[model samples]
Target: MHNNLHKTKENTSLTTDSEWAITHNNLTSVYRLMGDLSNALSHLQIALEIRKKVLQANHSIVDVSFNNVGIIYHSKGDHKTARINYQEALEIHRKSLSTVHPRSAETYNNIVFVYDLMSDYSNAVSYYQKTLKIQKKSSLSLIHPDLATTNRNMGCTYAALGDYLTILEFFEKGFNIRKTPLPSAHPDFAKTYKNIGSLFNKKK
Candidate 1:
């Protein structure tokens, strides 16, 4: 949020910051917060183009470009394109950062989502496991949404693979975690309970 606010502060040199990347990035963040995804995507695409022209393709800045555009594609329901872009970001992160870096975790998480959207459940499960492993290694176990993501995705993957026991195990863990960390009526907790109930109904 601070970045979103301060991004427009022109340089002290009495001139606009003519850096192509920064301007597009600031616009992208602002548009994203405003729910204007089309504008956000457009700005991010411009940012990526400029970064690629100025920096190496595998650099962190280039990786961010890939990630930002990939997210836009995902939000727009173009999972195939999203997967390719996420793969590019994943490769860049693997080559440049340690495996458990938060950036790498983000790439892994995005890839998992793309695979899930494509109905590639096996690959999705594999990526989700890798994502949780990275998050756990980062020692952010209490981060609500991420913790919920790990549990819910792991449960769904197990359910898809016909491992009902593991599905129940993870879903219950997620439910308990959410109930304690979030208000009991939080949507996350409610959704978890609904899923568990549905799963049990099928077994009856």
Candidate 2:
């Protein structure tokens, strides 16, 4: 995938076509999956630059580029930088769509994760609430993977706050939501199970 995208990128001028930005974005994903975060960030930045040049400042796609770049930074453990990029994406989303947009929810989720990493559990829960509100208000299904993820994350945040019963409720809800769509052997299940197990231990 990386090689194919690299070839496409070489053939297309960044300013001339949006495909060039797409190629870079694809390359960024490929690199991210490979755990080459440095390369992922570089490619993502190129894609962001291309998108900014080709699209309006408030364009949704430009916001997507920013959000994706934030993801790479987040994976790299640069929580502050990730938060900045996420906030930028959120601002763009606010400009481009309604206040309750799913894109805004996604950025809120990203910010929640960063705050979680920063040990700002209060902020994480606040953002998670916003995320859930938007997801529930949007056309997303009740059992959407994103909803499951937010539930699980919120459970973890509650766990950090030593709210064992609340954590269990959230964890159970997330588990129920995910069970239908995600395979039992999925990696996300592993994390959820670990969290539940730890919750039990805490209760003991």
Candidate 3:
């Protein structure tokens, strides 16, 4: 990977070129998968810097760069910084894409995830609501995996908020959605069953 990076750098006329940024972004993914978070962040920051210089503020690619950097920060346990970057991505999406774009929903989901990590259940629920609104209005099928995931996430957040009834509703929706495409033996079914079992225990 280091040799590849060297070769990429050598081939580029300027370090700030888009191709160089793409190479850094690719390296960031490799380092992240290897659990070398420091190097992952370093590469992503460089990629983001190059993207900022080469792209407009509301460019879709710049939004993607921000979201990727946010994911890295989230993996590193920096929820605040992750939220900041996620919000930046969301703002760009809002400015450059449709209100109900999938990218905006994804960004909302990212912010909700950080809020959940921070134990800010109310905020998580709020953002989750926004995510659902966009997803529902978008072109995604009713049984899309993303919708199921969001429903499951909402159930978990509602559980944290002590809204057992709402949790059951969301959980049931998610479970039903998963039932169509996934086999009975799928791990996702187990997870849904476990969540429902835990919900019942909490209710008792």
Query: Which number leads on lDDT?
Result: 3
Ranking by TM-score: 3, 1, 2
By the lDDT metric, which is better: model 1 or model 3? 3
Over 1-204, each residue of candidate 1 has an lDDT whose tens digit, in order, gives 545444444333312233756877888899899998898998888778778777776789889889889999899888998888889898998888888888887888888888877878889888887887887788686656677778887898777777788899989877766676676567776688788897888678
Weakest 10 consecutive residues of candidate 3 by summed lDDT: 5-14
After the best TM-score superposition of candidate 2, give how far the Cα of residue 129 lies from its true spot, in angstroms: 0.4
Give one digit per residue, the lDDT tens place, for model 3 in 61-171: 999989988998999999999999999998898899999999899899999989999999999999999999998999999999899999999999999999999999999
On a 0 to 1 TM-score scale, where does candidate 3 land against the true structure?
Answer: 0.86
Give the 10-residue window scoring lowest on summed lDDT in candidate 1.
9-18
RMSD per model, one decimal: 5.9, 4.9, 2.8
For each candidate, what is the lDDT?
Answer: 0.79, 0.87, 0.92
Lowest-sum lDDT 10-residue window in model 2: 8-17
Model 2, residue 122: distance off in Å is: 1.1
Predicted candidate 2 versus true structure: per-residue lDDT over 92-153, tens digit per residue: 98888998888798799889889988999999999999999999999999999988988988
| Better candidate by lDDT, 1 or 2 | 2
- Please state the error at residue 84 of candidate 3 in Å: 0.4
